[model samples]
Target: MRATTTLFSLSLLLAVSARNTYRSVLTDCLNTASVPILLTSTTGWADEIEPYNLRFTPAPSVVAIPRTQAEVQSAVKCAHANKIRVSVKGGGHSYGAYGLSGTLVLDMAEFQTVNLDQTTKIATVGAGVRLGNMANKLFSLGKRGVPHGTCEGVGIGGHATLGGFGLDSRLWGLTVDTISSVTAVLANGTAVTASASQNKELFWALRGAGPGFAVVTSFKLKTFAAPAVNINWSYTYSFPTPAAAATAFQIAQTWGQQSAPKELGYGIMLFPGNAFIVRGVYYGAKAKYDALIAPLLAKLKTAHGGVEPTKSVKTLGWIDSLTDLAGAALATPARGYDAHDTFYAKSIVTAESAPLSFEALTALFTYLYTVVPPSSAQWMIIANLYGGPGSVINSLPASTDPSSTSSYAHRTAGYVFQLYAYTANSLPPFDADIIPLVEGMVTAMGEEAADLPAYAPYADPELGQAEAQVRYWGDGVARLKVIKAQVDPMGILYNPQGF
Candidate 1:
C-alpha cells in the first residue's frame, strides 16, 4: 500500500510540474509580445471570453486580443511554438462554439476598424468588425454599403467567409462575393494577402473556407452605393388548423415559383400559435413596391380562404431599414455584446429544384405545434428568400465561376429554413431531446427535397461530423479536402464540421 501511494504521489507531482512549466513558457512567450494575453482567472476574463451564444462558455487557458496584423501573426507563432491549439473568435457568434475550443483563443474583437476608399468604393474591414457598426459607419462616410448579415452582432470574419446574407443579398450577392482580397495568417504563422492577382488559390479558399485553413486578419471588400429608400411591408395570417397553415405555405411556395423582383426581399415566419407572417422589403419607392406586391397579395388572400390578415406598409431610410431588419433591441447602440441570450439553432437550405410539398409542410407544422416542447423562451421557424431574380449566386455555373471555387455550396438554394429555440439557460436540460427534434425536422425537410444542402454558418452540432460536412459542402468537399491538406498540412486549425 505504501509503495502504491508513493507511486501515485510521484505521478501527481510530475503532472503538476509539467503543467506549471507549460504555463511559464506560455506566459514568457506572451509577455514578450505586443498583445494582451488574458488568463482564465483574470478579472476581465468573463467579459472578453463570453461568446454571443451563451450556450458555449469555453474555459480556455488563455485568451489573446491582438490589435494588429503583426500581433496576430506573433500570437499564432507563439501558440504554435508552445504546442497549444488556437481558436480565433471574431464576433463570437458561432452557434456551435467553433470559435472557442482551444488551449489559446485569439480574440479579434480589439481589431475592429472599417476604412472605406471613396474613389474605389471599397471597404477594408477588420475581421472583428460587426455588421451593424460597419453598415452605420459606411452610410455615414459616403452612403456606401456592402452585403452583410441581418444580425447586428454578427462579425465580418465568420459571416463573410462562410456566407453572409442580408436584406440586399438578392440585389447584391453574398458578402463573400463582395470580398476583393483577404489578409490572413497561414498555419505556419506566415502572413499573406490573397486576391485575384496574389495567392489566387488561397483567396478562393479564404473567401469561403477561411476558418478551416487560416486566421483572417482583415478583408478588402467591394462596396455599393446604398439604396435611397427601403419600403417595409408585413402581413400576418392566423390559421385555426394545421391544414390552413399548410395551405398558406403552399401558396407562398407557388408565388415563389415566379422570380421575385430583384428590388424586393421576402420571407415568412411561423409562430407557435398557428400564425404565418409574410414580411418583405422593397429597395425602391413605395408606389413601385405596392404595384409589385398587390397581385401577389390578392392571390395569397384567395389561397388563405376566409382568413383576414393584419397588414402594414412603411418606408424608411437605408439605416432605419437595417435597424428594422435586426430587432429594435439588438439595433440599440447601448445593447452590449453580453446582452444576447443563449439559444440553439439549426438550418437547412431548400432549393427550387425540389420544393417543400404541402403534405410535408403540414407535417412540419403539426410537429412544431404538438411535439415540440413549449418553453418560456421564444422559438419559431423562419424561412428567408435567399435566392431569386437578381441574385448573382448562380449567375455563372459552379463549374466555371471563380466565386464558386469556395466551399459555400448552397448558392442555388432559393430559401433557407431556420429552426431557432432560444432560452436563458446556457446549458438547457432539454438540449438532448431538443437538438434531435430540430435535426429530425431538417432530416424530414431534406428527405422531402431529395437531400438538399445546409448553410455552413448555422453549423449544427447534432448532425454528426461526416454528415455535417456533406451537407455543408456538397461536391465542394473534395476540393476543400485537397486545399485543407495543402494549407493546413499539419492539421493545426480545425473544427468539428470544418474541412
Candidate 2:
C-alpha cells in the first residue's frame, strides 16, 4: 500500500511539473508576440474576459489582440507549440460565451479592415467588423450590402460563418451562402485562403463549424445592391386568449409557406404578456408591398373571430432602414465596444415539410401566457421566416460531397425560433427561474422533440458536448471532425461544444 501511494504521488508531481513547463513557455510566447495581451490577474484581465452573455464568466489565462496577419500567426503558433486550447473572439457575442472560454484567447479586435472590389461586387470584410458597421461601410463604399443579423453588435466573422440570417435572408440567402472565400490561419500557423478552388474541404467546414477549425482573419463575401425604396411595416395585436394567439400564428405559418414573397421579410414576435407583433421590412417599392401583403392581412383579420391589428408603416432609405432595424446607429467606434446583456436563449429550426402541429402551437402559447414569470422579467419569442418557395436558404443541401457544399445544417428550415429570457438586471448570476422557464417554453414548442435541428450560433451552454455536436452539425459532424484532424489535430481552436 505504501509503495502504491508513493507511485501515485510521483505521477501527480510529474503532471504538475509538465503543466508548469508549458505554462512557462506560453508566458514567454505572449510577451514576445508583439501585441497587447491580457493575462489573468493582470490590471485589465477581468474586464477583458467579461463576455457579452453575462451568464458566462470564463477566466482565460491570456487575451491576445493581434494587429496584423503575421501577429495572428505568431499567437496561434505559440498556442500550438505550448499545446494550449485557443478561441477567437470576433465580437464576443456568443450566447454561451464560448468566444471567451479558451485558455488562450485571440481577440480579433485590431484585425478590422474592409476593402471592396467595385467591378466584381465583392467585399473583403475583416473578422472583427461588426454586422451593422459592415452594412454601413458597404453602403458608403458603393451602395452595396450583404445579408446579416439585425443585431448591430454581432461580429461578422462568427455571424457569417455560423449561418447568419436576417430580415433580408429569405431574399438573398444566408450570410454563409454569400461567402466566396475566407482568409484563415491554421493550427500550424500557416495562413491560407479557402474557397471553391483552394483549400476546398476547409471552406466547407468553416461555413457552419468554423470556430473549431482555425483563426479566420477575414471573409470574402459576395455583395448585393441596396434597394432604393425599403418599407418598414408592423402590426401589433393583443389577443384575449392563447387559442386566439395560436390561430394568428398558424395563419402566419400558412401564408409564409404559400403566399409570402421573397421581397417581404417578416416574423411574429411574441411577448410574455401574450401580445404579439407581426413585423418586418419590404425590400422593394411600397405600392407593390401593399398589393402583396393585403391578402395576408385580410386572412389574419378573418382568423380568431375577426381580430383587428394596430398598424404602422413608413418608407426609409437604405441606411435609414438598416439603422431602424438595428435600433441603433449602424456604425461602430474604432474600439471599446462593451454592449452586453444577461440572458438565456434556446433555438430550433423547423423544416418546410414538417410544420408545427396546431396542438403544439397552442401549447406553446398556453405555457407562455400562464406559466412564465410576470411582466417584471423580460422575454421574447421570435419566429423568423427562413424557408419559402422563393428563398435560396431552403434550395441548397445541408452538406454533400464531390466538391463539397457548405456545412450549414438547416437549409430546409422554414422558421428559426429564438426563445429568450432575461432578468430585469443586466449583470448576470441571474435569478434561478431564467433557465427552467426558457427551456420549458422551448420544450413546449415540440420542434426539437420532433427531431428538428438546432442553430450553432445561439448555442445552449448547458448542453453536454456530445449532444451539442450532433444538434449543431448533425451528420456533418463526421466530416467536420475529419477536417479538424487534418488541420487542427492538436485541438487548438476549440470551444466546449465544438468537435
Candidate 2: where are CA atoms >4 Å away? 1-21, 401-404, 446-450
Q: After TM-score superposition, what is the CA distance of residue 117 in candidate 2 from its true location, in Å?
A: 0.6
- lDDT measured at residue 287 in model 1 versus the true structure, 0 to 100: 83
Model 2 agreement with the true structure over 1-499: per-residue lDDT tens digits: 9999999999999997986677668878877877668767588677778888887878777788888888889988999998899898888899988888887899998877888898999999998999888988899899999988888889987898888988888889889999999999999899999998889899998988888787899999999999988999998887778788888899888788787788888888998666688989999988999999898888788864586788988799988998898888878763667788889888877888877777888888888888846335688889889987688787776585454469888877788888888877767668668888888886887654445678998888877888888888888888888998999888888878986
Q: CA RMSD for every model?
A: 2.8, 2.9
| Top model number, TM-score | 2
Tens digits of per-residue lDDT for model 1, 279-336: 8788998888888888778877876775558997879888888888887533323125
> lDDT of all predictions, in order shown?
0.77, 0.84
Q: Compare the candidates by lDDT and give the number of the best one.
A: 2
Tell me the lDDT of candidate 1: 0.77
